[model samples]
Every structure is written in structure tokens, then in C-alpha cells.
Target: MHYRRFGKTNLWLSVFSLGTMRCLAGESNAEENIQHAIANGINHLETARSYGKSEPYLGNILKKLPLPREQLTITTKLPPTPDSQVMDQWIDESLERLQLDYLDCLAIHGINTWEHLTWVESPRGCMQAIQDALAEGRIRHLGFSTHAPLEVILAAIQTNLFEFINLHYYYVFQRHAPAVALANQKDMGVFIISPADKGGRLYTPPAKLVELCYPFSPLELNYRFLLSDRRITTLSVGPANPQELDAPLAVADQDGSLTPQEIEVFSRLETQAETALGTDRCSQCYQCLPCPEMINIPEVLRLRNLAVAYDMTDYGTYRYGMFENAGHWFAGVKGNRCTSCGDCLPRCPEQLDIPGLLADTHQRLNGSPRRRLWG
Candidate 1:
């Protein structure tokens, strides 16, 4: 597998790191996948307290293996439970679940707002817990994961408290490019999540997108596009199974990559997709705030974008199922939760008609019959 310098850490990390979201679902088969990944040179394993049962399953698998903990890098996150005591409890629980004495890296999960930053960075905040864990040798490094506005990310980086960062970045979602660049400048490790959602759709893309990315598989084009930037320390790939893992590993070995001409074509394709969708690309800034129903507007917009951009109605359907069946659904806003207050309109830099676009998105994905304020 291709390896890149992990910023100033001087560690060479595989471009294809294993993500544990799906692995948690297959607890019965997680060992096999973990073994497969290790055998294939995937030295980095990423999980989180928020991903159900992932840490516990991984802990069980590691306990049975003979591999030394030092040979592997383990990354996980603490959920924003808000209470510092709860954060401490979560960290200890994570360590117990992972069967490790200390975490190589631990992040404050999902910092999407300034409020989140304040809570984590305050004296009585989660950062205190993180610092205590570091002092006690329970965590080697502290960091954070975010899908916030670029300014928020920039502000976090300025604190210089983190050793690493996880963020959403890819060819299609270039919002975090500036943050990635800043991480590079600071010698901090940068991890990217969900290239497929950010970059590829399982189904065929529009002909124009395909034409724009000639000589590269949609996956390869997207991966290569991100790898072109040196700031990216690692790219996390969520493979449903072992077979799906091969493509990304192969991408690491490519020699002659997409040329400038291909890049130009890809750019045109992105523009065309935006034009055709007719919705302002959500930068996931969450500037449109206080959804009456607490629906995560950016996440919904992302799912909608995936549905249209990748043409994977089934995938979109599954994502929609998460909203319908999951208990923690829409901690931010429910689907169709907008009251059409239009308060977020003036705040949006893109000037998108939030309510109108959401209505169209709801109709396109869930059909008109299911339409309502909180459906």
C-alpha cells in the first residue's frame, strides 16, 4: 500500500486506513476483516465510541491476536456527552473496549459548532479529561473530528493542542482543503473520512462526470484527486467487505495518474452536477441554525447530494432508514423539520432558499406522500 508522511509525526501511514463503522455491524466477522487488513499492510485502525459496538468488538479481536500494540496505531473518539466526568468515563470505557492500555490517538468527536469548541476547550470541559488521560498515560495524543465551517476548523487549529484531526474532505467536498493545508503547515496529522460519499457514488454518475474523469475509475479519480494534495496524511475507506478493500489498496500503487486535462474535465463535471442539482452545495457549515425540529440540515443535504450525484437510490434509501429507525436520529433536526422560518436564509453565504430546497429534497428522496414537517 502507498504510505504518506503523517504531517510532523514523521510516521508513514497507509493511504487506506480501515474505518470501523461497518465492521461493528459484523461483529461475528470483524476478526477476519481485521486480520485481513493487517495481513494486507493496513496498520492504522480507526473507530469511535459513537459507532455502536465497534470498540468492544475490536478489543475482543485484538486480545486474541499476538500482535504487539506498538506495531499498530489505534484511533478512536469521545462522544460529546457534554459533562467532563462523562467524557472521562467514556475514555476509560473505550480503553476497556479496545483492550489497550493507552490510545495512540483520541479525538473529541463531532465538533460542528462554536459551542462544541467552547465546551471541549474550557477548563471544566472535555479537554481537561483529555489532558488527564494523557497525563495518566491512557492516551498518547489528543485531537478532534469536525464537519464544521472552515473558520471553526481554522480556529481549532490555532489552539495547537491537537496532534491529529479528522475531517470531511474529498474531490467533491473541497470545503476542508484549506484546513488540510493548514494542518500540513502546522505539521499535524490530517485524516479524511468518507471519500465515496464525498467523492464516489456506488452507482454510475452522470455521463458528464464520467467523461470528466476519463482514464480513472470513479473511485480512483476521487482518491487520486485527494492524494494529489500533500496535506492529506491518511484517507479512511469504509469497506463493507474484503473485496471492496482491494480497489483503494490498488489506488495506492498507481504510477501515471490523471493528467491536468483530466483534472479540468473533472472540474467541469462537478460544476455540471451542481448546476443540474439546482441546490447550493452545502458546505456543511451549519450556519442555517435552530431548525425547529433539530434536524441536521447539512447531513440531510449530504444524503440528498449522494442520492442525486451517485444515482444510488438504494443507498439513499438505507441512509433514510437510519433516520427512520435509529433512536438518536436527528439530534439536530428531523427530516422535513423546517418551519419555513427563513431565519437561516440571510445567514447563508450561498443564499440558498433553505425551506424550498429542503422541500424539493424531501420530495425527490421520500416521495410527496411522505412529505410533512417532521416526517
Candidate 2:
């Protein structure tokens, strides 16, 4: 396994960290799965208080495993609270559940809005309790995970209060690229959340994506894309069983550079997208903003682009259905909510039919409702 310095935290973390959201779900082989991952060099285990049964499951598994405590890094997350006392209780609860004396990392989970940010940065809010924990050696590092808009993410990074950041910056959804760049500037560790699953659901990729990726599977291609940017520290891989770790482990030694084949695949993807969408293609620039209906026009349209260009209808539908269901984590109304007020029309340099395209997006990608993993 290849390890990278996780920004200012100064810890060498494996490029693929084990995300335990899907662990202990039903008839799970938790011990074998975790042990296999650890044996193959995935030294970081990430869980959350909200990932039902995950913390306690890890606690039991850790006790039974023969590994030393210091050999692995364990991290957990809790949402921000209004009161520092409540935050204190949460910390104690997570520790007790995990049966750990202290945590290698504690991330303020789901800072997905301005309000969530306020909850963390307030004078008597979670940060105070986190600081106390840090001073008392309960938490070795402080970080935050967010699904907020780019502005909110940039604001959080600008605070300089965090040693690391966990956010979404996938090969398909590069909207958070600026946030990643800023995190690198601040020397903050950048951990990508759910690249294979949330990042276009590459685990079950479409035919076009599979074809574009050529020799590499869509999952492997995405991993290579993220790891090529040295600023990214690690990616969360949620494997259900021992063998599920093999795909990511195969690409572990891929250094911080893209192969010539990778570059060709990237070019192929872009050219195909442009060719498929023609002049109506969304360039992903954020000029069209301040929608009257609070619709995330760019993201909504980008989903359409993916579906239209790459035949990624299933992936598009899965993500689109999570709009209202995900609350602040996704942070936008669906494309069906566009009122055709023409507010975003003039702002769009592409001069695209904003309302018509949104209608088409809603038409093409509408499906059963979906929710985020933590939602």
C-alpha cells in the first residue's frame, strides 16, 4: 500500500481508508473484512456515531483482533451541537462505544450549511469542547466533513481552525475543485468521501463510462484521477467483505501522476461529453446563480449532461432523487422546481435554455427517492 502525508496532520495515511458505513449491516463478516483490509495496508478506519451499529461493532472487533492499538488509526465523527456540554457527552459516548482511550481524529460531521458552521465556530459551541478534548489528549487531530456548497466549504477552510477536511471531490463531480485547492494551500488534509459509491456510482458504471475507461474499470480510473492530484490525501472505500478490498488495493501503488493511458481516457471523456452535448453543453461555470427557486442549476444541469452524454441515466437518477431527501447535504431543490423566471438565462454565457433543459433533466432522471448514507 502507498501512504501519503495527510497534510498538516503529519500522519502517513494509506491512500485508501476503510469507510465503515456499510459494515455490520446484516450477517456481516466484520472481523474478516476489517482484518483483511488491515493486513493489506489499509491502516485507517473511519466511522461515525450515526452509522448505526458501526462504532460498537468496531469496538468489539478491535478487542478480538490481535493487532496493537497504535498500529491503526481510528477516527469517528459527530454532528455539531449548539452547546459545548452536549458535544462533550458525544465525545465520551463515541469513545466508550469504540472502547478507545483516545481518537486519532474527530471530525465535526456534516458542516453542511452556514448554520452548521455557526454551530461549530460559536464561542460556546462544539469547537470549545473539541479544543478541550485536544488539550486533554482525547483527540490527536481536529477536522471537519462537509457536504455544503462551494462557498460554505471555502469559508470553512478559510477559518484555518481545522487540521484536515473531508469533502466530496470526485472525477464526475469536480465542482469542489476550488475547495480542494484551498485546502492544499492551508496545508489541510483533504480526504475524499465515497469516491466509488457517491462519485457516479462507478461500482456499477454505465457502458459508456466503462468504454471510456478502456483497460481500467471506471472505479480504477476514478481512483487514479483523484490520486493524481497529490493534494488529495486519501479516499474512503466502503467494502462489504474481505475480497471487496481487492480492486482498490490493486491501484494502491499508483503514484501522484497519471499514466499516458489515463490522460487519453480523460481526453476521451471530455471530447465525448462535448460531442454529445454540442453547443448546449454546460461548462460548469457558476455565473448563473441566485435562482429564485433555490435550484442548483449548474449541478442539476450537470447531471443532465452526464446522462445525455455518457448514458449514465442510473447514476444521474440516483443522485437527482436525493435532492430534497438529503437536506443541506445536497443543498438544492430539484430541477423540477425551476420556475422559468429567466433570472439565470442572461447570466448563462452559453445562452442555454435553462428552464427547458431543467425540465428535460427532471424528465430523464426522475426515479425513486434516495437519501444520503448518513441522512
Candidate 3:
């Protein structure tokens, strides 16, 4: 597997780390998959308190493995809270469940809002407890994982407190590009979260995308795309079984730079999108904003772009269904909430019919509310 320097942390990490959110006890081959990932040189194993039973399940597997503790890097996360004592308890609980004396990294999980950022920054809040842990040799490095918007993400990086960041940034969703750049400038490790599943659900990609990414599956292309940027430290591969690890394993040895032919495939994909979308294509300039109902017009339109251009109806529907139900993690109203006030029409450079397209997005993508993969 290819290894890269994880920014200011000074640790060399595998380009693909094993994310343990899907490592539940119910999956019969979970242990085997973990073993397979380790055997293939994935030393970093990441889990969170919200991922039910993952910590203990991984702990059991680790206990049975022949490798010594120092050979592996372990990370876990907990939500930020105002109370330091409570934060300390949560950290203790995670460590106890993992049966580990110390963690290589600890992330303040799900800082998806300004309030969460405050909780971490507040004096005598979670940061104090985390600092105490660091001093006590319980945690070697501190970081945060977020599903927040770009503004929030940039603000978090500006704090200069974190050594790493786990976030969503992949081929299909590049909205957080600035955040990645800022993190790199800050000398922070940038770990991408859920590239295959949340990265446009490439595991069951549309045929058009498969064809566009010739000589590689859509999954490999997405991983390669993220790896192309040296700022990105790792991509989380949340495989549910041993077989699910094969796709990432195939691409692990690669240097992540796109060849000339691969660049042509990306150009082709863009051309197809432009051809299909025409003037309706959203540049994601975000000029149209401050929706009365808090609808994320750009995101909705991006989903529409996927559904219309790439035949990603399943991915569009799945994400659209999470609009309101996902709380801070998604933080938006459905496209149907557009008031048609025409306020955004004047702000858009493309002068697209913002409300009409939003209504159409609602028609095409809206479905039953779906919760996030983990709490």
C-alpha cells in the first residue's frame, strides 16, 4: 500500500484507511475483513462512539491478532460537549470499550455546527479534557470530524487547534475543496470520510459513469481522484465484508496520480455533464443564498445535476431524502420549500430560474426521509 506523510502529525499513513463504521457484529465476515485490511498494510483503524458496537467489535479482533500495539494506529471520536467532566467520561468509555491504554488519535466527532465548535473552543469544555488526555499520554494527537458546510469547516481550520481533520471531499462532491486547501496550509492531516458510499454511492454506480471511468471502476476513479491531491492524507474505506475490501486493495498500490488517459476520462465526464445540463448546470458559485426556508439550493441542484447528467437517480434520491431528517449533519430544507420569491434569481450569474429548478429537483429526487448511516 502507498503511504503518505499525514501533515503536521508527522506520521506516515496508508492512502486508504479502514473506517470501522460498518464493522458491526452482525456482519459475519467483519473480523475477516479487518484481518484482510491489516494483512494488506492498512495500519490505521478509525471508529467513533456513534458507530454502534464498532469499538468493542474492533477491540475483540485486535485482542486476537498477533501484531503488537505499537505496529497499529487507532483513532476514535466522541461528540463535543460544554462539560469537561462529561467529555472525559465519554473518552474513558471509548477507551474502555476498545480495551486500549492509549489512542493514536482522538477526534471531536460531528462538529457540524457553530455550537459544536463553541463547545470545543470553550474554556473548561471538551478541549480541556482532550488536552488533559494528551498530557496524560492517553491520546497522541487531536483532531475533528465534520459534516459541516464550507464556511464552518474553514472556521474550524482557522482555529489551529486540530492536528487532523476527517471530512467529506471526493470526486463527486468537491464543495469542500477550499476547506481541504486551508487544512493543507495549516499543516493538518486531511482524512476523507466515506469516499465510496457517500461519495456519490459509486459502489452501485450508473453505467454512464462506469463507461466514463474506463479501465477502472467508478469506485477506483473516485479514490484516485482524491489521492491525486497530496493535501489529502487518506480516504476512509468502510467495507462491510472481506470481499468489499478488494476494490480499494486493487488501487492501494497506485500512486494516485492520474495518467494522460485518465485525465481524458475526467474531461469526458465533464463534457457529458455540460452536454446534459447546458445552462442548467450549477457552477456552485453560491451567489444565490439566504433562502427563507434554509434550503441549500446549490446542493439540491448538484443532486439534480447527478440525476439528470449521470443517471444517478438512486444516489440523488437517497441524499435528497435526508434533507430535514439529518439535522446538523445535512442542515437544509427540501427543494419543495423554495418560496418562489425570486430573490435568488437576481443574484445568480447564470440567471437560471432558481425556484422552478428547485421545484423540479423536489419532483425528481424527493422521497421518504432517510437517516444517516450512523447517528
Candidate 4:
């Protein structure tokens, strides 16, 4: 696999890291899946204490695999909650579960708010456990993973206590670019989470998206687009089954730089997307933000685009239903919370009937099963 200098850590990290977020804890095939990933040159395995059964499952798998421990880098995280003692116990449990003595990195998991950030950074809080781990050589480096607002995420990276930051940034959601740029400026590693699944459901992509992402599959398009950005260090994949590893492995082995034809194709894809999404859709210009009820209007509207433009109604509905209980993770309330005050209407450059569209969004996408996945 092609490797990159992972920022200040100075590790030649493979661009595609194996993520076990979706690994069925204790499944028999888990070992084979991991072995396949390793054979394909995915040298990094990122999981979390919270990822059910993944830690212990991987631990058992590693014992049977012939790969040397030194050739692999394992990372796991602790959620910043309860108290530092709980955090310490979780770490100990994680090591026990992984069958490993020391971790390459220990991330303060789900730093999704300023309060969570404080918990990680404060002396008497989670940092105490981390400091103890560092001193004991239980973890080589400390970092954080977040789904906070760009402002809060940037603030977290600016703290400089982290050597790496795992966050989401993909072709569909470029909102975290500034945070990544800040990480690059600070020489911090940027681990992009879930490029295929969360990055617009490319695995089961709509025909329109498949067509627009011509010459390359939608999955490749998404991967190459993110890899083209110099600031990104690694893209994560969660492969429970063997086939899931193939696309990521292929992408990893290739020279990441996009060719001139691919670059031109990228431009055409944007034009094609706009055409497919239609002229009257929410442009996502951000002018319609700052909703009175703090609703994530643009995101809900993007779901609408998925339904209407890409004919991905099932996908759109699944995403919309997730906001019902995702808490701060999905952030602001869905479009159903729109107060119809026309506050965002005047700001919208598209002159969209914001209230009407909000109503339509809920009617269309919130009636189905809510599918939620972790990165």
C-alpha cells in the first residue's frame, strides 16, 4: 500500500486503515476478514472500546495470525464520560480485550462538544488517565475523534495536545476542511473516517451518482477525491466481510494522484450533480443556516436531494430518520422542527420555499426505518 508521512507522529502510515466499527463482535469470519486486510497491506487497525465486541474479536484473531506485532499499528479510543477512573478501567479492559500490552494511539473518543473537549484537556479529568497511560507506556500517543461543529472541532485541534485527529471529511461533506487545514498546520495526522458509507452511501450508490462518477466507480471517486487533498493522511474502511476489503485495498495500492482525465471527470461530475439535483433545489449555499429552531436545514435538504435528484429515497429516508435520536451527533433537529417563520427564506439565495421544502422532507424521508452506523 502507498504510505504517507502521518504528520507530527512521523509514521509512514498506510493511506487505507482498517476500521472495525461494523465488525460483528465475536463473529467467526472476523479473523479471516482481518487477515485479508493485512494481506492487502492495510497495516493500521482502528477500533474503539465502544465498538461492541470488536476489540475482543480482533484480539482473538490476532493471536492466530502469523503477522508480527511490530508491522501493525493498533488504535483504540475511550469515550470522555463518567470520570477518569472509568476511562482508566476502559483502557485496561481494552488492552485485555485486544491482547496487546501497549497501543500505538489512544483517542479521546466522541469529542462532540466543547464540554467533551474540556473533559479531555483538563488536568483532573480524562487527561489524568491519559497522562498516566503515557507515563506507563500504555499508549504511545494521544489524540481525539470528533463529530463536533467545525468551529468546535477546530478548537479541539488547536489545543495541540493531540498528535492525530480522526474526523469526517469527504466529497459530499467538505465542511471539515478548515479543521483539517489547521491539523496540517500543526503537523497533526488527519484520519478520515468512513469515506464510502458515510460519504453519501457510495456502496449502494444511486444510478445517477454512478453515472456521474464515470470511468471510476462511485467508491473510487469518493476515495480519490479525498486522497487528492494533501492534508489528509488516511482513509478508514470498516470491513466485516471479505468483499468489503477489495475496493479499499485496490484504492490503497494505486498511486493516489488523480490523472488529468480524472480531474476533468471530477469537474463534469459536479456539473452533472447540479443538473441532476435540478435548479430549484437547496444550493447548500449556507445562507439559509442559523435556523431559528437550530435545525440543520441544509443537511435535511441534502437528504431531499438524495431522494429527488438521485432517486435514492430509501437512503434519504434512512438518513432523515436517524436525526430523531442521534443527539448532538446528528446535531440540529430535522426539517420537521421548522417553525415556518420564513426567517431562513430571505437569506436563501435560491429563493426556496424553505418551509414548504421542510415539510416535504419530513413527509418523504422520516416514515421509514432509522439506520445508524458508527465510523
Which ranges in model 4 have alpha carbons more than 4 Å from their true place?
Answer: 277-279, 285-287, 369-375
Query: Where is model 4 poorest over a 10-residue stretch in terms of lDDT?
Result: 366-375
- Order the candidates by lDDT, highest first — what do you get? 2, 3, 4, 1
- Give TM-scores for every candidate, taking all chains together and pairing residue i with residue i: 0.78, 0.98, 0.98, 0.93
Clashing residue pairs in candidate 2 are none
| Candidate 4, 65-86: lDDT as tens digits | 7878878889998888647887
For residues 75-137, could you state the per-residue lDDT of candidate 2 as single tens digits? 999998889999999999999999999999999999999999998889988899999999999
Between candidates 1 and 4, name the one with more favorable TM-score: 4
* Candidate number that wins on TM-score, 1 or 2: 2
RMSD of 3: 1.1
Q: What clash count goes with each model?
A: 6, 0, 0, 0
Error of 1 at 165 (Å): 1.0
Candidate 1, RMSD to the unseen true structure: 4.9
Each model's RMSD to truth, in Å?
4.9, 1.1, 1.1, 2.0
* C-alpha lDDT (0 to 100) for residue 197 of candidate 4: 77
Instruction: Tell me how far the alpha carbon of residue 358 in candidate 3 is from the true structure, in angstroms, after superposition.
Output: 0.8
- Badly placed stretches (over 4 Å) of model 1 are 25-28, 198-200, 203-214, 255-258, 274-358, 367-375
Full-model lDDT for every candidate: 0.72, 0.90, 0.90, 0.82
Model 1's number of clashes is: 6
